[model samples]
Target: MKQHFFVLAALCFAACSKEPVLPANIPTDNPALPANSFTTFNIAKGNHYCDKTAVHVFSDSSMSVKVRFDSSCIYKTIDPGNQDDINKLVGFTEGNNNHLHSARFGWRWSDNALRLFAYSYAAGVRSSKEIATLAIGQEAKLRISLLPTEYVFAVDDTVVTLPRALRSGIANGYWQYPYFGGDEVAPHEIIIEIEEI
Candidate 1:
């Protein structure tokens, strides 16, 4: 009888002392980059990291979800060689070779606000555009969908359209994983939550 009571108490303690579980951190070689040493991408709900970061690439299908991130803005000029200093945090993607990727999508902060952008590389040059804007921290439901003809941003039901690209068409390709970035390390952790739709 004493043994049974002790076993029951031990089981109760084990059940009550379970630790909080978090989503797995991305692998060191997260497959998003061709080179190593840029292992700063986290795959949880909210992530706040500074210093020109990128999430793993979602090389599957299009996704529409509710995303949340604080408007912690930092400015840095991107050096083309240091893969660590890229300016883009998220976009649609094509091209599986080298550093030459063509992507068009939105939701990066700049000028004290959030902006939409599209990028493509060709002829030894890269073409990028900051197409539109949104108010930060506004609980916006963002949708980045590639149509048969154009790249579209539907934020809370308002539509903004953009060109596809020369090297990689942003229509129906893989979505580049989300990114958190800046010139220096984040003053504080910057967490962004992406809720599946």
Candidate 2:
């Protein structure tokens, strides 16, 4: 009886000792971008509509754009809006409406200048800090590079590294365009870097 009990206990311990499996799509190699080649846009100016020159070049198969949000910066502009707007702005709105607005950025064209909005917060009763913006005609570059364990964004050589949890799972290779929508009285550009860490 004692021998049988010992065997049963050993079997149970072995079964519980198996290692946990990791996620399937973790990135390993560092992604490279063009040498000094980047997307350039002319800032639009006006209400709800602005004119912008388009330079549409899709990212490589090992790169992706992720949406990010600073919780301290929500509900500071306009009014409350849906997450679908984020998906739509980043060219992700297709079938379902499960949009996560906090992680999207793009551009919208109008009649005057090409307006730009970097980090936007849906209109609500929340106090947010100022929205980040790039000047009209300012050159912006998007490159994927590795600085130790973090993925860095090199905009005109100004590097910003994202958190490891969010950087590791980004989908590689996708196309994105500028989008514009809302009751704001001016066309704007969408410029943001979102992460889910």
Candidate 3:
């Protein structure tokens, strides 16, 4: 009787453990719409980061989204050349910055069950930050998929559509605002991308 009870408990636990819950507003069959529509950010550009920074803006009125690094490399005065520095750099932020490194993904109000995958990296780990924002607001519904091994973010229709992949990791969001140089020095390499779903 004891053995049977333990087996049942294990089975129950396994069954209950499933993927995280996605928003109910999205469709299961075609979660992403308007397949190939997207935009990108190149860190080489200027003044992309600052206090109250706004990255990308969606055309859909239902949602307004933005992505910011929000971390201060100026204060730390430490180039993220090692894991310890990388950890320290990532530790100082709140919200999604702690979990997201090189990538920033967001959806608008109309976006229901849509998924946004960002390919990013920590400061000391890779080069420039790259992003892909997918807008799936049409009937066909688009899907944005991540291939980690190949380092690719794609929109899938009949075939696996690949976008330009930058390094992948988390974005540290601690250094935003007056703390990042006290209104004297502005943030650098702050990349932002936007999409609609």
Q: How accurate is candidate 2 locally (lDDT)?
A: 0.32
- The best-first sequence of candidates by TM-score reads 1, 2, 3
lDDT of 2 at 40: 27
TM-score of 1: 0.47
Q: Rate the local accuracy (lDDT) of all candidates.
A: 0.47, 0.32, 0.28
> Local error of candidate 3 at 34, Å?
15
lDDT of 3 by residue, 58-100 (tens): 2211112222222222222223232111111111122234233
Greater lDDT among 1 and 3 belongs to 1
Better of 1 and 2 by TM-score: 1
Least well predicted 10-residue stretch by lDDT in candidate 3: 83-92
**TM-score (all chains, Cα) for each model:** 0.47, 0.30, 0.21
The C-alpha stretches of model 2 lying farther than 4 A from their native spots are 1-134, 146-150, 164-170, 181-197
How many clashes show up per model?
Answer: 6, 26, 24
Summing lDDT over every window of 10 consecutive residues in candidate 2, give the lowest-scoring window: 121-130
**How do the residues 1-197 of candidate 2 rate in per-residue lDDT, one tens digit apiece?**
99999999999988886676545664323222223233222223342322332222232312333332222112222443422132122322111221311222333322322222332222211111212244444434433443333444433444444322223333333323333344443233334332211
TM-score of 3: 0.21
How far out, in Å, is residue 134 in model 2?
A: 4.2
The per-residue C-alpha lDDT of model 1 at residue 139 equals: 53
- The deviation in Å at residue 138 for candidate 1 is 1.9
Model 3 ranges with Cα > 4 A deviation:
1-47, 50-100, 104-119, 122-124, 128-144, 148-150, 154-194
